[model samples]
Target: FDLVELHRSNRATPPGIVLDPFAERALSPADRGGDRREPPDETSGATASRGGSGARHDRLVALDCSWETAERLVEDFAGVHRSLPFLVAGNPVSYGTPFRLNTVEAFAGALCILGERDSAERLLSKFTWGHTFLELNEEPLARYADCADSTEVLAVQDDYLAEE
Candidate 1:
């Protein structure tokens, strides 16, 4: 289900003992289509889960401090979305791109989180370090900022993922 649907059903509260506001906010109706929109009505399809229950939403969330955590999230997502096609792309641990899977083993083969247009924007929004961290990679930032389109920006994971 989408954000609007979640709030409508009042099932916006996802599973688990705790809730990450970012994740919760992700399901909020206003956040569904983009950063625009004024929330949703009470009975929109966007709020209905595939199961007609909130269980699928519950399973989507996982908090992990280890690789095991990552694996489980992927497993659950794959299990729930077996029918709907999705592109999984991220680091080397998850499956690489250009491949499809109906199980977690696909993750073992290669984990590739496809940075489609929206996903790419989400990544850039979450990963940027602002002006302070920018000092560490002034040259690259200066070079990349000159580009107009987001796709034109080269993403150097090392600069963002590496521990300072």
Candidate 2:
């Protein structure tokens, strides 16, 4: 929760502050496979989802940067990496779009997926369009939060993708 790391380097992509291989690289269940949603490999169970226990730790990290840089800096980060399931973006720039959330929205969506709806709402309260995000993603967010793990989350996501 506290700001633990902030490296001010002369280089453009400094260490610690920016991150995310997961958020940028993650594809929807349907996107990962053709028509059928493939489950993650056996080795990925722990990192797949934070569903069952909810609070793995008090801290939640949200990475903000270009996709180009994110891919490069991904290995620099360390933690339980989990991707948010598909949710509609409510930010003005990418409104109604999927997988285009800004940093705050991404943070909120992660919080929602982690089963902390009230905390997520509080975090989103700072922005005007934030409420709209919750409104747009309410159903999926709730379903995702209730999932037992990534497999269940993927099943729920496949249902949404089927509607599109």
Candidate 3:
């Protein structure tokens, strides 16, 4: 979890990870890219802004800050981007809402969709509400992870969206 320091603060990445304080690569917002509609090619580019084929441990960056500060934290990165697929937010601030995850929840969701369910759980375990988030989103997270391509992921998201 390479959390680039956008400001002077005391936040730290979770234990036992790459936890680099500054990462050179910048990522775009997950929802900004049509690029995610296609599978990520085997390189770091617009399509891989979210977790793509190129989303190796080194490439993964955690924008660990409040959503209010995320804009300054994530300025105009030159790339395509896309949001995490459909899932309810379980954090106390936005429980049961869609796309309202905190830093840990957001990273955990990305991990789950990228086929790292166990790892995602481990990440969320750092928080007290982690299990609640999983309880609310486990099914969709698994479903999104199983999707082979972004097109399929969007299709599944449509199904969940219809429920709203």
Candidate 4:
């Protein structure tokens, strides 16, 4: 599918962009920092409003669901936004977290959106927060090693570890 250029422009790429673990790139011992996912904080642009521009912040709907649920979201996005691109952001647990109130009908609705199924898959594939958590906890010594340079590591140890 030819990407809608405007929609493509509106995409908010996940902050910590990382290559898939099983992707073509060769794994290196230096994979720690590369795989860590940091929590989202206020963006620089958001903090720079010295004066009001009168532009309202867009609404973001956060939810938990599975692949089926994601498909439904795509449908809604396309239906509501036939021209403009809408951004959808969520962690993997947003889907299939049974404790939440989601419905199969909603999932089906998402799938009904033409071409949205692929978009949903791509969205899920690009989001790696869940994967980052797994790598960090499961391999304590190696997580974030990919991101830490020698100076940063020293600073971290001195500042954070010294008290411990």
CA lDDT, every prediction?
0.25, 0.56, 0.51, 0.24
RMSD of each: 14.7, 8.9, 9.0, 17.6
Candidate 2 residues 1-164, lDDT tens each? Answer: 32222223213222111214354333222122122223321111012222332232334444455556655554444433456678888989889988777767776776677666776788688788989999999998887777766678878889988986
Give per-model TM-scores: 0.21, 0.67, 0.61, 0.18
- Candidate order by TM-score, highest to lowest? 2, 3, 1, 4
Question: Where is model 1 poorest over a 10-residue stretch in terms of lDDT?
Answer: 106-115
Worst 10 residues of 2 by lDDT: 40-49
The number of clashing residue pairs in model 4 is: 14
**lDDT, model 2:** 0.56
Question: Model 3, residue 123: displacement in angstroms?
Answer: 1.2
Better of 1 and 2 by lDDT: 2
Candidate with top lDDT is: 2
The sequence of per-residue lDDT tens digits that candidate 4 reaches over residues 52-106 is: 2222111112223354544343322210111100112223444433223222212
lDDT of 1 at 133: 25
lDDT of 2 at 20: 44
Model 4 lDDT, full chain set:
0.24
- Best TM-score goes to which candidate? 2
Number of clashes found in candidate 2: 0
lDDT score at residue 100, model 4, on the 0-100 scale: 30
Candidate 2 off by > 4 Å: 1-56
Residue 35 alpha-carbon offset, candidate 4, angstroms: 44
Q: How well is each residue in 1-164 modelled by candidate 1, as lDDT tens digits?
A: 12112322213323321112112111211111122223221111111112223333322222222433433332322112211112232333333332222122221111111112232233223432222222333443343334332233323323433433
